[model samples]
Target: MKKHIVNLWAFIHLVAHRFATDGVAQTAASLTYTTLLAIVPLITISLTIFSAFPAFQTVSTNLKIFLLENMLPESAGKVISVYMFQFSENAGKLTAIGTVILAITAFLLMQTIEHALNGIWHVRRARPWTQRLLIYWAVLTLGPVLIGGSLYVTSYFTSLTLGLGHEVHGATLYGLKFTPILLTVTAMSLLYLMVPNRYVMARHAWLGGLVAGVCFELMKTLFSNYVSHLPSYTMVYGAFAILPLFLLWIYLSWMVLLLGAVITAMLPQYAQGAMAGEQRVGYQFDLAVRTLVQLSHAHLRGEVLSLVQLVKLTHIHGEMLEQVLISLQDGHWVLRTNQGWALARHPDKILLRELFERLVFDAHHAQLDLGVIVRQPDLNLSDWVRSSAQLKLGEPCR
Candidate 1:
């Protein structure tokens, strides 16, 4: 029990630290603005898809109710739902070019979300625009249809069970009440798994999704209560209250979503760092040298070192390991492969002095600009750098 308590505290600390460092507030605010721009177009596109199916057409109102109820606080949900219904109705009057533009605008929202998720994972690479366009198009087109199908199936089952018997119907109703939570978790898991370029463990994705789903439900309940009791928005803005209230809710929703992402990205590091008793040691020359040597040995032996393997072997936090690996790749000292990292050149060609100069000394000098000012006449920086390299990389491999 004590150990579990310690682990929980450590997890919270790591998440708080990363949440601030990753600038989640800024990212969430940006997403909130983008979402507002795309919301109408996205809803129009989804409603269009729903209308294409005769079965879904009859129950579209129910679908809208479900979405609004689960997604927004009560009063805000009602306001947004009325506006969305009107907008979706008018969307059919648009020209071909306007429709195309509307679809692209909806895709922009997904693109922005992808960028934010990638930032959290420290992913520098991005899919090509052509690939992204196809992916995002499919999501925008098929996503609504799939959701409508699911809702249809659920409703069918509920009605069927009701006709059969009361006992079974009661159980079905109880299970259906949790549908919002299930859907939220499933969507969040997929987002975490697919948005970032890096591979996320399934367990981590599901755990993060579960946390986000629970928080979302709780927030909806709390916000609705607050809005109902507080009359502040209505008093201040009068008829215009819904607009600002909607914006505030969207901003808060994005903040919650990004917080879940932070938790997912940092979970591996927090778990391992706690066990290893790791702290912010920053970048040390010795640590870098050791990391390179390990990768070098694995490469020579035809062994692939995974991120988890490297973390365990080095007893280093995953984030720090990623940072070191990225720095090595940038300097052409290492190359990343599908399996893992490998040496860019033969170990023999990688001199200890040169490695240290590229990875450590250069980084330090860049930050401090030590070369910009004249040092004391007796001080010899080059000799000191070489000696430090030798001490860190004694008996160089190769």
Candidate 2:
């Protein structure tokens, strides 16, 4: 029953921590409402410009369909469609004004999009002004141009593939399917090159970005399929179902972004550490020894005690003890002796016992050591250490 309660409490705390860390969800909701307010004017400005270019007729329609189908909420789409019709009627006179308006609109849109994507990717760095300017510029101008180019490529490829649909067998279809894969790889490469604060190893960035992209694509498909399946929340919270859905999705998206960050940060270091480990055996033993010194009250002696006895008394492993003694010897804390181990400098025998006792007392489990330390939180291993050094120098140990 106690274990059950502890588990329940831990789960509650974990949930609280997650909500506390969720900057992305909070920022996304803020941007979503702001973008909603700007949606109609933004759509009208785009429609006006596209109407002037006959070559972009199909591109514009496809863009409109894509945005309406994928990006906007149902209510927001209706508003955009209404504004688009009105803009279509006045396209001739609106051209020059629309161009200026479009620039302003694109700036707003890119700012929001960049903020949203950065939030999604959990990018925490203060982006330099030069880089930020370049990113905004690319997203504002090159973004639409890229979308146009991608549509053109996809259309051409579809035409080619459809013509030879029957002639393309399993292997041929698989080979031709490289178009989307190539496009994905190219986009992933660009994101790695552009989005990071510092330089990322190309191989690590490629894999991490590909994973993010794949996860994003899967989420998009899953969201589209199940978005309407959110039951009438009357049974759960009635009219408030959308609130939970939105909040939950935002949380899920943030988790995905954090996962990408972890993958990118840890993978390369992990590979390097593994290779380094092969060349350095017994590193753990050395680390354990260092930790022992850090944990102890006074330097160990070589003549009075060997590492074997230290390990036996402390319940630390033999290898770990050897490492600790070797480190101490290297530091000139102890000297070789005919008798097992002894301090390099002769200290008062009684003083050595007291310091050794204190060290042993500290190395116990925390719960057991708490009683002695609680009354003297200011006192540390250093007090005993300095006392032992003083005894060696013939100073009184009071």
Best candidate per TM-score, number?
1
Worst 10 residues of 1 by lDDT: 368-377
Q: What TM-score does model 1 achieve against the real structure?
A: 0.78
What would the per-residue lDDT of candidate 2 be over residues 158-236, giving only the tens digit for each residue? 5776887656557556654544444444455555545554344577667766765566556655764565464544478
**Candidate 1: clashing residue pairs, number:** 0
Whole-model lDDT, model 1: 0.78
Each candidate's TM vs. the true structure? 0.78, 0.46
Give residue 260's error in model 1 in angstroms: 0.6
All models: lDDT?
A: 0.78, 0.51
Q: In model 2, what is the error at residue 305, expressed in angstroms? A: 52
Model 2 regions lying over 4 Å from their true place: 1-22, 30-57, 65-102, 108-131, 161-189, 228-262, 265-398
In the range 94-205, model 1's lDDT, one tens digit per residue, is: 9999898888889889999989998998876677788778767777776777678778877888788778876554667677888778888877877887777666778888
Per-residue lDDT value at 289 in model 1: 79
Question: Which stretches in model 1 have alpha-carbon errors above 4 Å?
Answer: 52-55, 165-170, 274-321, 335-342, 351-398
Cα deviation of 215, candidate 2, in Å? 1.8
